[model samples]
Target: MTTSTGKGSIVVVTGASTGIGASTARALSRHGFHVLAGVRRAGDGDTLRANGIEPVILDITEPTQVQALAARIAADPRPLHALVNNAGIQVNGPVETLPMAQWRRVFDVNLFGHVAITQTLLPALLRSEGRVINISSIGGKLAMPTYGAYAGAKFALEAVSDALRREVSPLGVEVVVIQPGGVRTQMAARGVATANHLAAQMTSDQETRYGGLVQAVNSLMDSGTASGVTSELAARVIVKAVMTPRPRTRYTVGRDAALLIRLARVLPDRALDHLSARSLRSHHPRTPTVGVLSRLRVGVSS
Candidate 1:
């Protein structure tokens, strides 16, 4: 795990309490980088500290906390070597029914928050000619049904990462995006739960119209969580991005992600639409006719 340039290097990893973030932090620490693991909760910080990485109490969505973290790092003599923006949340629902609040919350955590942290740390990064690694998603490139909020934020993040890369490269700072497919994580479970909750809140008429779609989305999420690549695999890619002298502008971390990206590039829009429709229909528990017929039968019996 050791890296030629990573020995004693200082790196900050946000959302380090679990999944890819946690794995990346641990991997970097083992590779001889001094990892400052940022966690939202004090208990999470304790967990990181127990693992031998320095824990910083940070909530990327909160500007004060981000500023405090930056100030603390700036006070140290060592220049920051890397900043990994890995904190994000997934919210799933039909765009028409999804709450604007949820969309804002997702963006706050996934896009705006990371942008703030990156801005705050730019000076430190510039001083060391460091790298900014943004953990985006396959959804960022190819939006999926019921993932509008999550995808929107990720899409925005991709654009921001691109702009930042161009702007900071002149200053010797590298900006890269890591797009991972379904990685086995709690996020899948949370997404499924959120889908269910959102579906439950729908009116009867709305449910009649969108229930199958909701079920399909939940099914997809379950499969993703069950079959996704390991977070460790993602962490390996992140470490490579950080340690490589010349890194690509973006890296797809999982096989599925790479395939999706390829498909997005090569497939015609009409073909992709057909594929997406097929996937949804295949995953849906009940066909539209079956659902309608079942409801009619229940109505007649009553």
Candidate 2:
């Protein structure tokens, strides 16, 4: 770890290779924070350095990396002001048919990794009276069938955030959950690919039951990718959370995130499920395909 005198508050961002994580690191650096960009690969670190950002080699699931990150931060004369636990993976399929390995892998990075990194850095955060931001999804509140594993981990993260928020408020550390409805990212593309792949693998009867639903959701997602707020926009919101005198415990962003998730909450489970099914059937009106990237490219340009 290269030690530099902190001209501004220090921020550590996990999963800083791409998507929200990478964009957030760049945005925060622009905001004048001494951004410690965290990536699992050294090549990513080199890219960050080329861009004039400090890249810390980190793998949130690895205890040693987390510990090493803590040591590096602890050695810094300046206090660490913020930590963004934005590293996550999306694995979607029929819950009954999904491999246990998929579920475990998601949890390892999405839930437990956040806990481990936060715990390791709690003292520094407390000392600086900083904020910990967890990038969760609206799926944490509304359980989507194929999105079960990812949603489950997010739900657990929400609980963890809520509990820790209360526990640390008095101690000067703030915990914030940024729940996004959707955004144009690799996670979305991967989800579409997973659905299309699984649809191909399943029996005709199984496909008949779940195929259209996946197609509809993918259509909805693909429709929104271009219009959804860019990662840089979302990062600005997060930076505000860190800088604000009083930050909200929960922030739901993106189009219709609040209304849709709230509706899912108030509606009865069976009724919501029915509504979801109907929405899937009618709202999208498109077929699922593994070619999400091309669609996203065209959609972005349009």
Candidate 3:
């Protein structure tokens, strides 16, 4: 009940309103750890309240909310054991088309928000010799056609994790990055919806250039999620990272993630391009309903 696994102690999981975060909170609580589940709304918190799970209203992008989380931990009787930075938003648009404002918003929620919370809670994590579990995507290593903002932020997060791990492991804290492939989360649905919304606002020229590609990527997202692992399964990997004595610095959540990470390591840049373009081609429309695959795909030849 006392040492670092948070067993009978405390752990915090953000974005607990649904998906992997919610599943992780539940799994940790079941392991006898007290879980502070972070949600954006009180109703969501109410839905998660249970024996060992306490739901906290947290929007990681908000400074006030982040400080409140730190304060709550400061007052708790149990030592804080881990901070799961699992909250994220998915935004997809080509580099030239995504608005500047949207780009900032993506970084704010995906990258900056995690950094702020980690900085605020470092004292407690260090005190407990706890772990910081960051949920990254396979997109972190493999950037696709329309994932300009999302993947850029994830790539930065991966680098930050490396730097933080080097700085903190010597200080008794562990930073672990979780690379998930297409886990069947609501994120894919939300991402596709957002992508379509942005596509609708594109100029005629932008639409002509990107519209078909966007549609193809959306289809790919849907198929990927349909074939993805469950949130509970993904949570099991996170729990392992939390419970293991000397966990690996990074873990891939599913088979797709593991294979893709391997491919990223070995595949050349041009090879990745052709692989990506071919994958999208299956979902691409025929007869040039919008911009035809031939027009959309530039570098990859038939």
Highest lDDT, which number? 3
Stronger candidate by lDDT (1 vs 3):
3
- Give the per-residue Cα lDDT of candidate 3 at 21: 94
- Residues 227-275, model 1: lDDT tens digits: 8899999999999999998899999977889998899999998887887
List per-prediction Cα lDDT, in the order shown: 0.85, 0.79, 0.90
Clashing pairs in 3: none
Deviation (Å) of 159 in candidate 3:
0.3
lDDT of each residue in 1-302, candidate 2, tens digit only = 11222345789999998888888888777766778889989987877773436899899999998999999888888778889999988878777666788889989999999999999999888888888999988888887768888899999999999999999988888899998876777778877777665555655556656665666776766766756777877777777776777788988878667887789778888898887777666655355533443354355456
TM-score, candidate 2, is 0.86
Ranking by lDDT: 3, 1, 2
How much is the lDDT of residue 206 in candidate 3? 83
Off-target runs (Cα >4 Å) in candidate 3 are 1-5, 287-302
TM-scores of the candidates in the order shown: 0.92, 0.86, 0.94
- Higher TM-score: candidate 2 or 3? 3
